[model samples]
Each structure stands twice: as structure tokens, then as C-alpha cells.
Target: MKTSIIIADDHPLILKGLNDFLLEKKYNVLASAVNGKEAFELIETHNPEIAILDIQMPFLTGLDIAKKCKELNWKTKIILITFEKDENIYNEAKNLGVYGYVLKEFALAEIEHCIDSVIKAMPYFSPELLSYLEVEETPKKLELLTPTELDILKLIAQNKTAKEIGELMFISNRTVEKHKSHIIKKLDLAPIQNSLLIWVKENQKHLE
Candidate 1:
């Protein structure tokens, strides 16, 4: 069976181009939407195998959709396409369980490679995106977890179950669990109240 897909982008041309490209690739273009609401409707209805979402949309952002999708346990893999290559977005996508992320500026060839790599059960980042010099925070957040801990937390926020995150990060589920515990403690977050995911969103800008 062909891999099913739904693409959501506010731009008409992008939606059409993505649809045409995926159709040419022999992937089933289940649906396309210009905004988050339409995308949500089609996604819930069709249950496509993959979803290509633009980070900036009419009403709801790609980040919002990703968080909701994680909650639903939707089987559709998501590719977040955006012009923003900042650390915050990367951290957010990693946390939200998005299957892949591609920049709008990347060549079609790079995007294709990213898609193929993601389908093969690997995380994909464009050379340009990864090569962008990281602007380190002058001083680390004392209340924040370590980089790895944050990474695990980001995946948690993204709604990835322990095992799924483990597979992506090449770590054990138990390790992810331990990181979760440490993250909670470091952030002094009360259990069963504000979720770690909330902390991630609240403090995302500082991660870079």
C-alpha cells in the first residue's frame, strides 16, 4: 500500500506543489488544507499515514498541531516545514514527536532525502539547518535540565511515548524515564499539575 499523506499550508502554491510532488512520488495524497482546522478535519477523517504541516498557518501554528496530534496518538508521521531554523523550533519539533523537519529554503533534493531518511526510521536534519552556528546561552538555566535531559523532555512534550523516543535517540526507554524524573526535579515542577510539556513551551526560547 502507498504511504498516505496530508499537507497543510496556507499558501495555495505550496499546497498544490507538495501534493503534485508527493503524487509523483507515488505516495497517496490523502488531502491538503490551507489552515490548521481544515488539516485537523482531514487528518481525523482520513487517518493518513503522514502529515506535512507548515509551521506558520492561518490560525493554529504547526507547533500547536503537533502537540495535539501527539495527544491523539495519531499514527501519521508529521513533517514540519518552515522557514524558521532557530533552536527553539528545532527543540520544539524534537519534543513533539514530529517524524521529520525540513526548511522551506532547502532544495527539493534535500527535502526528498529528508523524507526518505525519516521513513527509514532515522531523524533527518538539513546540512544548512544543522550547520547554522548555535548561539549558546551565556549561562545555563540553573533551574533547567541538561542538554540531554532537555532533549528527552522535548520528546516528552512532543508526546512521544518512552519507547518511541528511545528508538529515535538511540537510548533506552528506562533512560528516558530517568531523564523525565530529573527534568521534573530540576524544574521543580509539581507532578500532576503543570505538565512538563508546559514547561517546555513556557521556557522554549532559552534552550538555544
Candidate 2:
């Protein structure tokens, strides 16, 4: 039998596009909703095997509906679609036992695979989202650095040479190099040539 699915998004175009795509794939789309309340209502009525929902919606968000489904002990699996790459939201979705998390930018390309994973009772999260989360977390890792390391990192970000940094800090070039090594170790950066300078250039904003 074809899989039964419910899809919801506040944006009409997104709703239409997703609904059309799913229909084209020959899945039985039980309903499409423009808001979270309507989507949850449809879910309750149709009892579909899967629900693909937008994270932001009027009345209730996708996470809200997922929470409700968990509370009701429903068998329906949820696949959330959103533009947000927020760590807190992602963690909350995991805590709610959400089956899939997809980014809107890649939704059309990824939804089919996401649904397949859901059918197999496996969790799926967008690779782009995961990469974004990793980049976002890199800043937080700066907390592992000491004040001296942070100052050195800031100087490195400013394109300072080891001799220049040493002169500015009243330290020797060797001490500056040692500090750079310590900074690299604390940040868990690769030991490749100019790797520290490359990292500083890429993450300069975090130094501020």
C-alpha cells in the first residue's frame, strides 16, 4: 500500500510545491495544511504514517505539533522542514523524537530520502544543517582558550607576524610561537602550515 502522508506549511507556494511533488511520487497525501493547528487537526483525523511540517507556523509550530503527537502516543512520524539551523531547535527536535529534520533550501531534493528513512523508522537530518551546526559550534569552542590564548588569537586574526606579536606583547618570538601552538592545540586545529593563520582568517569575527 502507498504511504499516507500529511504536509503543512504556512507559505502557499511551499505547500503547493511539496504537495505536488509528493503526489507526483505516487504517495497518498492525506492532506495539506497552512498552519500548525490545521496540520495537527489533519494528523488527528487522517492518522497518516508520516507528517512533513514547516518549523514556523501560525497557532503552533512544527515542534509544538511533534510534542502533541508524542503526548498522544501517536504512531505518526514527523519530518520537520525549516530554514533555521539553530542548535537549540535541533536539540529540541531530537528530544521530541522527531524522525526527520530537513532544511527548506534542500527540501525538494531531500524530502524523498527523508521520507524513506522515516518509513524505516530511522532518523534523518540535513547534511547542510549538520555542517552549519559544526561551524556555529566552533565559536563556542573558543571558551576552551585562556585569556592569553584569546589575545594571541586576536592578534593572529589581525594578520600579525610572530615577531610583531612578540614585540607588541613584550615577549620573545619563541614564546609567541609557543603561544600559537598552545592556541592551536586548544582550538583542536590541524597542524598544517599556516593552519592557525587560516583559521584566524576564517573565524575572525569570533575573536571580537
Best by lDDT: 2
Rate residue 163 of model 2 by lDDT. 86
lDDT per residue as tens, model 2, 1-208: 5799999999999999999999999999988999999999999999999999999999999999999998899989899999999989987886677888999999999999989967865567887987787633368779988888899889876767788889999999999999888887887765644456545645667889
Q: Candidate 1, residues 3-60: lDDT per residue as tens digits?
A: 7778899989877877887788887787899998888888899988778889899878
> What TM-score against the true fold does each predicted structure earn?
0.64, 0.65
In order, the Cα lDDT scores of the candidates are: 0.72, 0.86
Question: What are the C-alpha RMSDs, in order, of all predicted structures?
Answer: 7.5, 14.4
Q: Which stretches of model 1 miss by more than 4 angstroms?
A: 133-208
Report model 1's TM-score to 2 decimal places: 0.64
